[model samples]
Target: MVSLTSPAEAERRPYGPRHRWVVLAVGVGAQGSFAAMFSGIPVTGITMRADYHLSTGALGLVLSCLGLGVAASDIVWGLLTDRYGDRRVLLTGLTATGALLALMAAAVTPGDGAGVVLLAICLAIAGALGGSVNGASGRAIMTWFAEGERGLAMSIRQTAIPAGGAVGVALLPWLAQASGFRAVYAVPAALCLAAAAATWRWLHEPAPAATATASATASATASTTATASAGATAGAKEAAPDATAGASPDIRQKSPLRRWDVWRLALAGGLLTVPQFAVLSFTAIFLHDVKGEGAALASVTVLIAQIGGGAARIWTGRRTDRGGDRRTYLRGIGALAGIVMAAAAVLTDAPTPLTVAALALGGLLANSWHGVAYTEIAAMSGPARAGTALGLLGTALFAVGFLTPLLIPVVIAHASWTAVWAIAAAACLLAIPLAPAAIRAR
Candidate 1:
């Protein structure tokens, strides 16, 4: 089983005190590089539709392909991370993704139905490869950072999504406009390659002593807790073993596939993504078709949302690290996201700027909870099973990611954009109930 090392142990390693930071940077790079593809690809929705001669529904299918691929592969990658380690999985996945994107850039072109089909197939494959980033990078953070610091560390890692999205929205639309989709594909390929290099050079396992120390710490904590429960009433005593099960090294070492807390958080996380993906997948098109705004304004709005979301994630992480209930924060964030999305739905016919601001705010709030949710998942499952827990969460998230886009167009056809946002708001609200009530952080 994989074990988490404290920062102090990391500092004493031969690689230098700052080596963990290097690992964090590489994690950020790996995640951001893939984010550039999955999150950024939607930024080019307008261009893709025009170039590929696709209807709105067809465009959504293309977008959903990436999510579908990710959903399919995340669990596999997560299991692999537990077995093979972070560096190897990340290197293999990132390198292959880069090469695939390079080939896609050269071969994919505007032409017939075949072109759209081919592009979708390639994107699905890219998403599968890129899915490696989440579990591996997250596990690396869990391994290197202690409990007190992991919220912040993981939040910093989570920022890569919006940060990469910011870069993609800022650059890819213009690239698609100025050059073509070829350039857009090439850019992410380069990012993947660069991140792969960094991972190869820097990411490595913690010292064996650190792993042993962490295991001992976990066992000691469990023993203390079990001892404390010894004097409880009969009913409490009966529940003691189950309550302390998560703290046991034996339980910690087991796969997190069946953990109710893990599934609860995973499902909640998936539901929360509805609002986020709504903004991400359709904002540009909405601005263009409904608000009569150009791609530039749409891109700028998305860029602002991404930047704000990233900053919000960092702040939320730090705040939770200091003192706060992560589950409480998560539910609160979800509630606010639902409220904001509902307001956005109501304001769809309002003044253009007001509508834009509402959507942007909804996007920001929807995105801000990721770090907290992920931190809760890892903490509940323990560091040894962080990969499996994270992977399970990823599968849920990307499965929702897959479905949201494809369904959005159908909602638009039958109902309206307001209905779409309303449903998204409902999804956020629904997720609030699913968050685990309390978790004993590892």
Candidate 2:
């Protein structure tokens, strides 16, 4: 039950607790930029349709290619981050993502079939490279922040997704409108390259401190058994396996996928993400196509939704850090999401001001639990295996990203947008019960 702090922990840590703001800043930038680029395809769907004369189904395929690329390669990236360290993996991945995005921009040519295929290939490749940020930056922040404060830190870090979505909403539309689709891609590409440079300068590898990982339930079970001893109760209570779990190699030597807790958390995270993906990838299209809003109005609506979600993420993370059952918090979030989305589905009309408010609320509640869920995942696995764990989780999540759009159209074809949204709501509600199982297993 005894724990030892690494002497080089300070040196290996990317930032001390006081300087932890640095990790927060870098995490947001790296994640935000990657989120922007990765989610930009759907955001730019209208522009691409005009530029390439493509259909909705075709656009879905293009976006699916990118998601497929991320899902297929996330495990590799996660392993690399754990093996080579966050800083190196993040820098390399971010640099390559920017460069590949630029190449995709160049490959674009209006009305050229071959060029469309080429662009999809480039986007797929870029997505594979961009995925490194998830595992790397996630591990970095987890390494820097302690568990008591990590909820806020990770929530702030997770805000990058919506923050990046907001960035994409703001920049991609304006650039596409002003210059061309090419300019839209170039902007995020430039931001990513610059972010990589900043990351190189600021972030450090927490290799020494990183030895504290793998939150095994066996150790906690041992602690609980010892809790009966009066003198050892406090020590027993404090003894989570995170203090004793070995480094990345030790983690890698074991099978992450074999861990039932990891599988539970991963599945929960993946299922919870369906609603978020619906918000991120379909908001603009839904508003434009179903609500009869103009492109500008649709874009702004989606942008507002993303901004709201981002703010909610930070606030939710901070409160969760203070104390309480995080799984309960996530369950509440999922329930709220279900109610909101189901109401929207039944209303069948988005013309009123109230509909806008509901949409925004839906977006906020749909996305808010992300940070809390991540905190649970990190606690279950610790920093050493977080990347690999996240990778396994991300594959399930992004596969939804790839398939959801394609499936939405099919539902709309057979039923209505109401059906599609109701399906998303169902996914959210299902996540509620999944959380308790994940928690119990942990």
Candidate 3:
């Protein structure tokens, strides 16, 4: 039997020099795969709506259906990652996702409500399988990276979302026009398969120190020190590597989901991401319907938003590392997100450049918090239960991911697009006042 590292053992063995980076790279690529496939409907919303004769609200339901599936499956995937490790979970998920995407391509029929429903079901399955990527990839990164670099590392991993969104927004329209929406699905499927192969070859669990090595290390314990100390997202953990370095052989029972701090972070995170998802879901439609931009051009603005969001993630991620109050930083960003989203929503009738500016800033600020949030979870929970905590957080956050698209259209129909964005802005601002535990969990 291939003995995997217990969580304690994972703590003892320092991550390999180059292997960690390779893991991060492969993991980010897989992240892109997840984002691309789930966001496919919205990215190609224009063509899909026309083909299927979907009303705005109906389209929202179809797009959000996939995220609903992701929300449902997120925790399950997290648990699997904790038990089976990131490699097995991610590889299996991505590979299955590829096959599902192909089935979606072959199965969906244009202009049929039943066809849309069928496509939605396929997407939901694909989303669930793809949901495997987030928590597992995060746990792997937490295990391999020390504290000093974790924010930046997680930031890069987080980029997979916006980066993939950008690719879908920029390319999928052309692909849809050229070959049909089926071709668009084919791209993600191919990418998933390729990512699966890369993951198999490159990803490895942090090796557990054998008994002999542990014994030897005890004698020379003073000679080594970790750059990152032990901690949890909301829980206050001491910085002693020796304290829990040889934890129980089974670490699955130490779940972080029960902690209030974890739940707080999860809830706040879910709410804060609403505007970002809203923008991603509606920008193409809004611009096409309101801004008079063609499909490709309208997509250009959202594509730029993704680019800006990625850059902001990298910047803020690096900044979040030198932290006095990670939770406060999160809070501040949440408030800022609300302000920007509301402004962007109202910018519909403003000058084109100004409208684009609001969207860009909204994208940058609204979506940039993942690295910081994930870092806090890993720091607080340690590698032992990071998967579960991250997974729990993902479940909460993506629930909004599932709902925002579905709800946005209702607001648009009852009020206006401005009202839709204003509501998203309020969601972020509302999260600000309910303070979670600070950098150190009590």
Candidate 4:
């Protein structure tokens, strides 16, 4: 996989291997916030219901607001990172989000309209800023790693989302059980603040060095032009393409929409997301409503899924490193997910252990494509515009995710619980063709 990297990309990519782990750590930290922010939906539903006297629909509205925030802010954060840099945006966003999460914790209480509205606003901010993680972290990994190794690295980074979410699910409930729902928000707040500090201390904008070098090179070229013009050589009067001007054009032309590869990545990302978000958003509901499970049991089941998804993420990354085709793996995972989801739909009457285990395995296979898909995008786009490409991919996937709650309820309303699972299975099936197209584009 010889990467057709621009000189700017080549210069920006870390030559030494030491920076890879640092980039991975940054990715993990950024992604961990995503899990924390979104985890509120499952644990805080009862609290919100009690506090705000929210109906089921009202609770759904509150949760959906977070998705709306992410959808609205993803592109903005992406552009900011591309233009200014990731370090400042990431650090500031994380810190602000952490404070807001804590504030939201205090504000969301019984009979508190102002509090609820404030909480919603804060959640929106968190979602929007947290959305930047994909772009910033993906860009870092892509810029720091070589093509052959990027798939594995990017996969590992992608795992942080599920892994972080799983931790949140496990921790928040136990905390809420012992203390209150406030603990759920409080824990993430602390973690987010810590991540913000860590990012500030350790993160560096790798491209600044490249920019400086380009600037110096431009200055030297200008000096040469001045000298040539002073000599008044008619042969040298032709305006050659200045290296600095060429570099500036490269930056301007880095839009992901202009690239065929980016569109394929986004489409494949959307296909993969349809199922993953469905499970993430609704697993607790399925356990509670269909399987006659309690909140505790449902939360536990969701936690199991998260664990499977997280472990599978790291494993998938390692497997990709060992020469697995990402497209093949994604389609295979999707197919397996569809089969398992179908079984889950039809076998809803199965024993508790069997049903739970089936869903856990389903989660594992369904979410395993996280690393591979992003890795492919990073590889396909090369390093220079990795952030832009990943930003577009995240936008498409998150946009699909925004529909999960709405779409799934429609299935559950018209049909039996089995029909809901069947719908998810169908969604996974839709990903089959896209997987090969995704790999071919890479």
Candidate number of the best lDDT: 1
In candidate 1, position 178 carries an lDDT of 90
Summarize candidate 2's per-residue lDDT along 149-209 as a digit string, tens digits: 6667888888898889777877786677677777877888998998898787777644433
How accurate locally is residue 313 in candidate 3, as Cα lDDT from 0 to 100?
79
TM agreement with the true structure for every prediction? 0.88, 0.84, 0.85, 0.80
Please tell me which predicted candidate would have the highest TM-score against the true structure: 1
Give per-candidate clash totals. 0, 0, 9, 1
Ten-residue stretch with the least lDDT total in model 1: 232-241
lDDT of 3 by residue, 1-442 (tens): 1223345655555544456778899989999977776655577888888877888878888889778888999999988888888988888898899888776666664622346678778777878888999899999887776554567789999988889878877777788878887787888888888888888767777554332343243223222322232323221132223222233434323567766766788889988888878878888888788788667766776777787878877887765554324676789889898899889878878977788778768867887888778777665666777788888888988899889988888777788877877888899899887647443433
For candidate 4, lDDT tens digit of each residue in 252-290? 355666866567657766766666666666666677666
- Candidate 3's C-alpha runs over 4 A off are 1-15, 109-114, 209-254, 435-437, 440-442
Quantify all predictions' global Cα lDDT against the true fold: 0.83, 0.70, 0.74, 0.65
What lDDT score goes with residue 234 in model 3?
Answer: 20
Candidate 2 overall lDDT versus native: 0.70
Query: In model 2, what is the error at residue 28, expressed in angstroms?
Result: 1.4
TM-score computed on alpha carbons, candidate 2 = 0.84
